[model samples]
Structure formats: C-alpha cells, structure tokens
Target chain A: MDINGPVESTVIEERPGRRRLPPQERRQQIIDGAVAFFAEVGFDGKTRDLAKRLGVTQSLLFNYFATKDELIEAVYEQVYLNRLAPDWPDRLTDRSTPLRDRLLAFYTEYSTLIFQYEWMRIFMSSGLSGAELNRRYLKHLGDVILRPLLGEIEFAARSGGTPTMEDIWNLHGGIVYIGIRQHIYRTPCPDDPSVAITRAVDRFLLAFGVEQG
Target chain B: MDINGPVESTVIEERPGRRRLPPQERRQQIIDGAVAFFAEVGFDGKTRDLAKRLGVTQSLLFNYFATKDELIEAVYEQVYLNRLAPDWPDRLTDRSTPLRDRLLAFYTEYSTLIFQYEWMRIFMSSGLSGAELNRRYLKHLGDVILRPLLGEIEFAARSGGTPTMEDIWNLHGGIVYIGIRQHIYRTPCPDDPSVAITRAVDRFLLAFGVEQG
Candidate 1:
C-alpha cells in the first residue's frame, strides 16, 4: 500500500520494541519487499538477498513462499494480472454504448495502470526472464479483451464487417505499442497519453474502414 | 559466434588445450559473454558471476572493462546499436523507390535483424534496468528512421502532406510492437514477420490517406 521507496526490510528489526505483525500482514510485507527488490535488482535476484531485505531469515521467506517461482507469481498477480478491472469484460461487450466510447474508456483505465514505472519495469523483468507469465497474460488479454472487441467492431461496422485477425492485431497492438514506447522504452511522445490514445483509436477506426458520424 | 545456449562462460575452460585468444579477441569474448549473461540474467547480474562464467578472474574482468556499466554499454553496442543498417536512413528517403516499397524493404530487414531471441531479450533487459540506453536507442529510431520516413511520406503525398508525429509513431510503433509481442513476449503470431510487416505498412498508408497507385 505504501508506494514509496523500496520496502525497508530492516523496519521490523530496527524497532526492537515493536510486536510481530499478523501472518497476513507479514506475508503482504514480504510481497511488497519482493516487488521493490525485483524491480530494483531484477527477477534473478537472490532469495537470500530478498530475505535480508525483509529482515527475515531465508527459512522464514521460504515458509511464506515455497519457492522463488511462487514469489514471482505473487508479483505477477499483484502487479500485472490482478490490475484488470472486474467489469472490463462486461463493458467490452456492452452493446448499448458505441464501441468507440467503450474502447476509449477501457484503454484510458488500462493505460493509466500499466504506464507506471513499477508496472512496466516488473512486466519487462518477467518477460526478459523467459517466463511464461507474459505469454499467458497476453493470451488472457486477447481472449477477454481483443477477440471480443473484434466481434463488437464487426457488429458495429456492419458492411465493413469482420476485420481479419491481422487487422484486429494491428489496430489493438498499435495502442499497446504506444504505451510500450512511452512506458517501457521511454520514447518521448509529443502528445499527452490521453491525446495519444484518442489518436490511436481514431487511426484504428479509420484503418478498419469504420465510418463515424 | 555460437548462436546456441547462453554464451557459456566456460568456453575457454572447456577447451583445455586451446591457446588463449589475443587481447582484442579476449575483449570481444568478454563482451559476448556479457551480452549472453545479461540477456539471460539481466543487467543487474553480478560481475563475479560473469567472471565465473567467463573462466576469468574478477580482476581480469575489471581490467578489460573498468566497470559493469561499461560492460553494459558494450552490450548495447554489440546487440542494439550496431545492428542498425548504415544505409537505412538513405534507403528510407530514396524518392525513386515507391513509398510503400521503401517502407516494407526497411522494416523487413530491421525486424529480421532485431527479432532474434538474444536481441529482444537484451533489449528488454536494458529497458527494465531503468537505464537511459533504451530511451536513447528509441530516440535514435525516431530521429534516423521514423522522422525521415515521415518527411518522405509527406513529400510523396504532396497535397495531402504529412500526418502528425502521433501518426508517424503509431505507424512505426505498430510494426515494432508486433516484433515485441512475438520475440520478446513469445505471443503466438501466425503470420510470418514479413507478412505482418507488409500488412502494417499497407494499413498505415491507407490510414494516412497516402494513395498507392
């Protein structure tokens, strides 16, 4: 919850007069430390070092997380997977609103979440590790987000209907690519992200031959 | 260079009877090892571990490269910067070539070079490290490649003129995103990269109101 500097592992140790945290709180503490540590040192960072950061012994760290893989998964869950909006799938399919409005709304929220320094760094760390997490995460995005949006665009466009999967990826991937250039690779963009998102969505609509009133 | 497994640090050790490589060859060997090692474990990987992998003493490692930052710079040179085709900017602006043809020609070669497992992995690792290398690399891409292409597109389109910087980045970033999804994130992409590149170029041309006769 504290989005400050790296979680200090020495906090508990420094305060010799303090009582031990409840198990759930302690677990959350370890996860916080892991996120900051992994972001700083990367995923191949040592478990012993992580325990040291947490001011806990390696054995205690292992007791909470059976393995490094488990701890990494917790990072993915905390940072990547669980950030998805609970109602995104429903909003993505909501036919009452025009498809464009829903898209702009969804991406605005999604980008705001993903474009942070912490999120992008950890996401890149997991990716560079050759882990399956990113693949699985992108597939989830395709299934829950992209494919359904494709279906909606088809319904809305009517005569222009059923854009090829290639087009679908190009359109959607273009927006995500924008975030990556800015957030991950730190390319300077002339437009604000909101402006960039709007332009990207407009470009996609044009490229797909979706007519606007 | 052996394109297989992480460049083994034990390469010299494994060849017990082989004579030592000359100084230049030795530096190149260390650079190669750093590329492979950093690509696998990221830039935060320990110098001592890299020395162990290289079958060299830590002192020897430092002698060749004064610091880890210098080693990382060597990696950016070898894996990222040096891969840029020298004539690419010229090719991008050669007016005799049709705009679409020129665009496709450049990206196909660029993607083929950059989409390698090592290239993408090291790229993502550098970006994750919060180092300025990726930003500098992306800026080079924008300056040398994207901005020049935008000028050519404007000249070719004449009356329609150029689109905004937002559009240029969207078009260029869209194609690079495909590479990131496939090579770095391991997303399943059924189209060969060349096919995908062609499609992206076609869509960009269409979106920017560039006519292809």
Candidate 2:
C-alpha cells in the first residue's frame, strides 16, 4: 500500500513549457481537453496526463484551476449551460402549442446535445455517489438550467393531448436512457433504435393524452 | 507499454503447501468471491485484489482459473444462471395472455433485477465493445425465454401493435443501456425510477395490446 510514488501535484498541476492564452481561451482549452479526456477514459484519467496533452506543466494547470475535481465541476457547469440556452427555452412559453409536442421537441434537442457531447457518461457516472451528489447535480440542472425549460414547458397549453412537465421528464428520461443503452453500450437490440424510440415516445405521448403522431 | 511486469505462470501446476478441495466446492468458492467483488468494485476490480480479499496469492487464486478475465466471465455466467431461475421465461409463451401484459411483467422483473443486483452494471458495461458480448447477453433472453411469458401478453393478437423481433431487440438494447446508465452512471431522472419503470411498462403493454390493468 505504501509503494512510494511521484507527487500528485504533478498529477493535478500543469506541467511546464505550455503557451499561455488569454483567460477565456485558456479556460475553453481546458474545458475541451477535459471533455475529450472524460469521454474517452473516465474520471480516473490523470490531470497530469491532461496537462501533458496540452504541452503545459502541472503547475500552470493549477494556476488556472486549483485542483482536478474543481476542474470537473467547471466542465460540468459549462456543458449544463450550453444545454440550457436562453432563447429556445424562453420561446417555449407558447401556451398555444401542445405540451407533448413541445416536450418531444425538447427531448429531441436535449438528447441530441447529450449524444453530440458524448461526455455525459462521465458526468452522470460521477453523480451516483449518494443523495448529496444527486441533489447537487439536480440543483444545478433544475435551478439554473431545467427550471426555465420547465417553466416554458409549463407555460404551454395542455390540450386534450398535452403531457404534463412531470410526464415529460419521466418519459424523456426513460427513453433517453434507453437510447444510451443501445447506442452507447451497443447492447443487442431486436428493433432499430429509431423504431424503438418512436414507440417509446408514442407510449409517453399516449400517457400525456396525445395519440401517436 | 513495452515494459515487462511479473511473469505469471500459465500452467495449473501443483505448488508447495497447496491444499486440495472438491471441484464443486472450489468452483462455488471462486464464484462467490467473484460475485461479491464484482458487486462492490465492478469488473475493473483486479483479480489480484480479489486474491488479497480471499487471502490467497495470485498463483493460488489463478490455480482455479487460467486468467482474471475468464474468472470474471465465469462469475457473471454463474450469477446470471443462478439468479434468473425458472418461472421467468414461462410467461413469454403463455399464448393465452396478451403480449403487452407479458412484456410489462418482463420489464418489471428486468428493472427489479438490475436494481437488486449490484454486479449487473459490470455485466452490461462490458457488452459495449462487441456484438459477441451483446449476443451472449441476448441469447439467454431469447424467444425461448419469452415465448411462455409473451403468451399471456396478447402481443401476437395485436397485429398493428406488436413490434417485430428485430424491433424488440432494438428496444431491449436501448432500455437495457438506460437501466445501466441508471445503475452505473446515475443519470438524473425527473421522476422516481421505480415509478418510471412502471409507467414505461404500462406503455409497453399498451403497445403490446394488453388491456391496462
């Protein structure tokens, strides 16, 4: 257990000889590096390795962010913000549209973002520790990002076919997870994913009072 | 990567002070340790680590099996075969019942097992890399398993509602991954997972043409 190892400051801090960019660019570079790292290798991938990838010293890396965990939080926040764009959500206050259709659009957009980013597996995996982690993640999601979306969704008029916000969340979460299992894990699927997703979505819409489109 | 480590012995040869046990008991012991370890730390947990936990050296631990990966696979197959006992696939063929109801019951059981067994995440996450992995996982869950249960599901009766076998495979793959995300990654859900599973089950049953109970 006590095999002597290299100091972890080298692990968390940036290495020497890397170029210094402006704060905005530097932060973005770090975020991009982090996303690729987390997506390919998961949280256990070393920060020193990340710094090396950017040709920077660990010390320089720490100058921008004190620790690896803090860097992870920042990456997560950035992704969450990108997902909760103000305009799309703000415009969702159309009470005239059916909530189910609105939510379907939202799920499509959200799922697309998750698929595009591809780092959700890492962020979401790290959140499984306990209630505290779950709550913190949710607080970030619900309070900062999803709340407005929920508000807009709620603002939509419930026709005889509209799904409630709760139902949208339920069905959306379920279906998205299903898609991840198939495409991400490459689990054996009897049907094509698009077909399965359509069916699952149809069922969710059915519960929300809409007949399948 | 080229650096050589310890030269592990390939042969299952007699070592000094080696104690012998009945083959059945020995296999059971190995399987139990594997299940416990896999449940707690997942497949990435080292076989060497498992040896330490079992109070055996690497050589002794490996005396029972050729390699670590094989040991893990053995444990997975053992747990799966043991845990998923009879009365399950029966409903798949209960032709008198609606297919949707059968599907719902299967969904319920599937969700319940993943939630109940801590090692299933390991089993599923490993399936991502290749079709062989998914094939092995799905072969056990094939039509033979479903024929009895699906008999009551009224799926065949609903010509418009029944998803083809390929459709079922895709849907199963998707849902399984989602369940693993919930299991491994702990993705946030808007509703309680159990409740969502129930809702999804109902929706699946509805699609299968079962009269919702």
Candidate 3:
C-alpha cells in the first residue's frame, strides 16, 4: 500500500550496471520511468528523485528532457496519447458494422489499454493535482470518439428521437467507471470486463431504439 | 492553478482574533478545515501546516484529535459517511413507487451530495494515496444502495433475466461519472445532472425488461 514504492511489476527496472542504451531507447526508458514515478507520486515529485530511481545522473536525465515540465509533457504523450488507437474512430464509425458490435469491440479494446495501475493511477493523480493531461485527453476523446459515436447512435436509432452527446458520454463514462472501480478504488472487477461492456452497450442501444440481434 | 492555494471560497477561514470556541464547535471547525486542506494538498500535507492554516497551535489541534489518523477518520465521517442519507436504503426499496422513479430520485439526491470540489477531489486523492477511505466507502455504497437496487430490478422485471450486482454498478457508476467528469476531469458537465441520471436509470430499467412509465 506504499504509494511511493514500486508497486507495479510492469515498470521497467533500472539496469544493474551502466550498460549503454541508444539515445532513442534511453529517452523512451526515461519517459517510461517518469510515467511510473509520477503515477506513484504526484507531479510535485522532484526530477532528481526520478533520476535516482532510474539510475541515471541528474544531468543525463536533463540531457533527455531539459526541465520537469518537458519531462511531464513526454509522460503525458507516453501514457495518454500513445495509448489511443488510431483506427478506433474509423472502426466506431464504420457503417458496415452493427452499432452494438462496434461498441462492444471498441470498449473491449479500450478497457485493455486503460485498465492498468500505471494508467489509472497517473490519470487520477493528474486530475487531483489539476494537471491539463486529463482535460486534454477527455477533449480529444470527445472530439474523436464520443461525438462520432453519438452520430452513429443517431443514424442507428429506430425511433424515440435523436440521441445527444451527453447520452454517448453516459455510455462512455459507465464503461470507464468499471476501470475506475478496479484500478482507482482497487475493488474486485470481473477478470474479463467484456460481459459488463456488452451489457452496457446493449442497454445504450436499447435506450436509443436500436434493435438488438 | 495553484493546488496549495485557497481555491475554494467555501473553506472556512481562520478568524483574526483569538476567540475561543466551544469544544464541540472547535472540533467541527477543525474537521471542516482538515477536509478542505486534505482535498487541496492530499493526506501527506503536514499537520503543522494545517494548524497554521486553522490559526491554532499544533497542540490545540491535537487536543481535539490525538493523531493525524484520528483527524482523517473525522474527515472520512464528515466528508463521506455523514453525507449518506439514512433513509436512502429504505426509500430505494420502497416498491410503492416505480423502480425508475426511485433510481432517478436516489441518484439526483446522491449527486448533489457528492458532486462538489471537496467531495470529489478528496475521494480521488484518498484513492491515489492508497488510503482505506475510498475502499471502505465503496463497500458501504454497494451494501446500502446497489444491492437493494438490484433486488428491486429483479422484482420489477417484466420478463428478462434478473439483474446482477454488476448491472446495478453500471447504473450507479454511470451516474457517478457525471460528477467525476465535472469535478475530476474539470469538464463542462450539464448544469443539472438529472436529465443524464434519468436517462441512465431508464436505460437500466429497460435492459432489465421493466417497462418505463
């Protein structure tokens, strides 16, 4: 339960000796370390401590990223942006696929990327600390994912009026909350979340008057 | 934004003069300040700093609550446990009213209590810091609210299979996510969340084969 301790076994460990890594590999290693470090502690964690944890000299750490803010930007990209699958939007909007099927597939894939200790902890920490990462990420999610998904819902609705962005957000949020329960609150969640996700997508489609197979 | 700075105008400020308060009043006052303090700075914030903010000697603060853990327990009571409407469990099972109506009403009432800067932020911080508060609160929530709601769904179902605990969690988590969006992600949420809550409840009811009125 030590928040600052290395809790996640997935976090890349420091090499025992000074085995030389390529500049690109070293930079990625530093960003990965920063992601884990910031996830464990808040953003107020010192870079010197981060360097020590990475087993790199502070100056060498600075060589990769000039300032703490710059390092944080890389962490944001590595943790948040990098995980977003580029084809998700296309697959979500693909008219060939049934809306329920698309939603089920999308959420199943999405949960796998997000339902991690590092991702969830870092996200909660950033939001608590008033960092721009969550806001920016959510904005992007709405723009690329939720908004388009809303359009798909509207297209697929059989009757009972058009769905709004908020409805789509409701579906999205409900799915995300499963991850929150597991990672943030450390509650027991289903080993495979697909069953829950399937139910949610079915409920959402039903609400919008879409027929279920 | 300055996380440490006074962001919330609602935080009770220290009085200028040395006006003594009754033991009961002083104790409540410290709990209020501690809630705000921890919400802003997380539990790792120093007691010395908290006493300084409260305009009390550290000794005086300790007189009310002997240890930081005791002070935090008071905070958990004040911020979370105290907010639970004692009548909620009974009212949620009140089958006289339709299940959808009960859910909408319950979530509306619950959202008002939880959808605040202090409540949401403190809850997230506690979770991230590995405090037992979030875990304990969620267990209480499931027992008092979600389980009973699931039973109500099964009783009201017109046909389809009985709803499960996971289904109830979907409905609950979806409703709570509106508050999370507003407070945690600092996103623009509907000014009134009832519309969204109603939709989620209706969707849940529909999925369970309960006819909507």
Candidate 4:
C-alpha cells in the first residue's frame, strides 16, 4: 500500500520515462506546484493542473507524487518552517522580558507564518485528518518542540500539568481552527476584536498563568 | 451582472424565486438549504442540490437566491453567530465563574458550530473574499457587536487611545485573519496532535487581555 497524491487521481502514473531528475528536484517540483495550486484553488484544486505547470503527462506526475495526499505531505514538509521557532529551550533565560512578551514572540512568529500562508488553513480543513502524511507531519511537530516546551506552552494551554503530545496538538489545533472561522470563514464575533489566533494565545497564556494585562 | 450558484463553475447566481415567499420564511429556507448543501458537498457542492433538497427546481433556486452572492450571504448569516454575542453584554461581567471558564464556554460553543459546519471553512477558503456577501456580513457584525463594544475594542486596537470605525475594522480583520489561517487553512504545527477547538480560543484570548491563569 504505497501512499499517493490526490487520492483518486495521479497524473504521472504511466509516464515513467518522461524525464530523469534528481529526487530532491522532483520532490520540490511537487511541493511548489501543490502550494501554488492550493493557494489559488484551495483543497479541491486539481493534480492535472500541477502536471500542466510542470509541462509533463499526468503519468509522469503520478510517478513523482503517486497521490494528492502524498503531494500535500511533500508540500507540508517543504513549506513548514519550524526551525524558526524562538529558542523554546532557552529563550526565556533573559528574565528581563515579561513572561507574556516572551510567549507572544514565539506565538506571533508562528501565527504570522501561518497567517501569511493563507492556503495552509485550506489544506488542513480538507477532511484529510486520517491521512498518513498529515499524521506524520504532526508527529514531527510533537518530536520537535512541544514535548520539551511544557513550561512555556503552559501559558497557552491554561493547565500546568505537563501536556501530552496529543494535548499540545489539540491545543494548537483549537487555536488555529477558531482563527480560521473568525478570519477566513468571516464568522462574526463580539466587540472582541481579537482574532482567533490571538484569542487562542491569550487563553493559552492565561491558562499557563500569564497575566492578562 | 447576474450571479448564480456555480454548482459546476464559479458560483455566480442566486435562487430565482426569492420574493415569492414571505421575506423571513424565504430567508430561512435559503439559509437552511445552503448550509446543508455546503456541509454535504463542500465548497464545490452544487446549488442545484440545495434546491432539490428544498423540493424546488434549479431555476426556482434563483427565486430565493438572486445570485451566488445572495446565497452566500444567507449562509454567512446562518453560520456567522457573532451577532448573537451581544445578546449577553453580561458576557463581560459574568462572575459566576472565572473569566477563563466563561471564555472557554464562548470559544467551545463557537468552535463547535464551525466544526459541525465544516463548509464554513470551505466557503471562506474559496478566495472569494472580495464578494459583497462578505462585506455585508461584516457590516452586520459591526452593527450588532462592534458598534456597542466600540470603546473597549478601540482601546484594544492600540489605536493611540482614540480611533475611528475604520481603525477598529482593520484591527478586527487582523485577528479574524489568524482564524482563517489556523481553522480554514488548517496549517499544521510540528507539535500539534489532535484537531480540537480550545487551541483556537487560547490564541484568541492571548491576542487580547481577556484570559489569564
């Protein structure tokens, strides 16, 4: 059972001999194509279009991506920039900054990136929660920063207990989900001018004992 | 100049018989049908299907919705529950429990509704942000919540202590923009594990001074 791209439709399935490129190049092609496509057409955006962008047969495309899911995973891997996290392990040693400000730096940078790549929300909302690629991507996130950042993230999740990988995951998702609704979904809200991301961070920090003022 | 549902293409028109039914009933009918259609078929779902569900013809669908824009407005009206927030000015003063608990209640209820109507994200991620429906809906929100909560929200905007309506609107859009990224775009973090709504709330709270542990 090989993972695939776009689930039902793989463009390059039959074009095995179309070209010979480095694995890195081919993978980048798929990632670049998927991001641009999603940015424009969103989740329902097609794979054939990606083939068109690459100027190759659908089979050749399939040879690289296998399925849209695979392609999306590749896109997630390529585009996500977690290496940029404000040194969660040691940034706060500078006790001069308020705890809230330090937390905001981490959050603002993360949310800014997320907000900048608007199509990222569409990718997650595409009912692909069950996909192996998405799961792996999430697993990577857990391994990278969350397991070690309990004390820091405590200001966000609101509970002092060491958060499990899943708790951390859900906490982040909860923030992103509501943010999508308020901003992307254009859902209404009270005079509370805070965006979903800001709101999530606000609650998260409060949960962790960050002073609201 | 005519906008009709783009069941197959970019949606551009509305249901044809809007004026035939009484205004309230007609509005309700269209809202119910549109929400169902978006939920069942997603952003690309057919408006014809919505009419069929209502036991109406494709052309008759235009009666209730004159253009695709009109129908989307109906969907926004139903799905965007922010208008309901001001019903509880008491929200700001609810000491029955901690502010955290009250806010969690607000965030949970709001996030749950969005989750159930997953299309809420799709409808937004469609990149049809420039539509009149979107503007009208936001204006309505200002009327219901922002106008009344203007003073507090203005201060929240950090707008130099005195701001105008446009300033508040800009700040609000920024926050909502975050929601769009996390929930609608579903950007994955390296550490996130599950797809819960609390994370969104926490982020929202952090953006403002509402939540504190």
The candidate that wins on DockQ is 3
**Real contacts recovered, all predictions:** 0.62, 0.24, 0.73, 0.08
What TM-score does chain A reach in every model? 0.78, 0.64, 0.83, 0.54
Q: CA lDDT of B9 in candidate 4?
A: 65
In model 1, what lDDT does residue B153 have? 76
Report interface Cα RMSD per prediction: 2.1, 4.8, 1.4, 8.0
lDDT string for model 3 (A1-213, tens) is: 223345664534445456689999999999999999988877778888998998888889889887888998888788876778899999999989788888888898889989888898888887876778788888999999999988988888997677778888888888889999988888888988889888888878887789787
Best prediction by TM-score:
3
lDDT of 4 by residue, B46-162 (tens): 777777777666776676678876787667666664534554446633465655465456444544444433444544534343345555655665675446445543334332234
Ordered from best to worst lDDT, the candidate numbers read 3, 1, 2, 4
Q: Pick by lDDT: which candidate is best? A: 3
lDDT of 1 by residue, A1-213 (tens): 333358755444443433478989989999999988887777878999998878777788888888888988898888875776779999989988878888889988988888776787787777766678788887888888888888888877744335666667776667777767766666775445777777777656665666554
lDDT of each residue in A1-213, candidate 2, tens digit only: 332246533343333344558988988898888877665555556888887777767677687888888887776666555555555554454546755565566566655566542445554445432224544555555555456655553343243344334444454455565445544455444343455556666655554445333
| Model 2 spans with C-alpha error above 4 angstroms | A1-27, A46-81, A86-93, A127-135, A138-170, A187-199, A211-213, B1-27, B46-70, B80-90, B124-135, B138-182, B185-199, B207-213
Backbone collisions counted per model: 2, 49, 0, 88
User: In candidate 4, what are the lDDT values of residues A1-213, reduced to their tens digit?
Assistant: 444556745454654545778978876776777777665555566778777777766677677777877777666565554534546546643345665576466565665555443445444544333334444555555555555555455534444443444445544544444444454545543334234445444445554555654
The models' CA-based lDDT, in order, is 0.77, 0.57, 0.85, 0.53
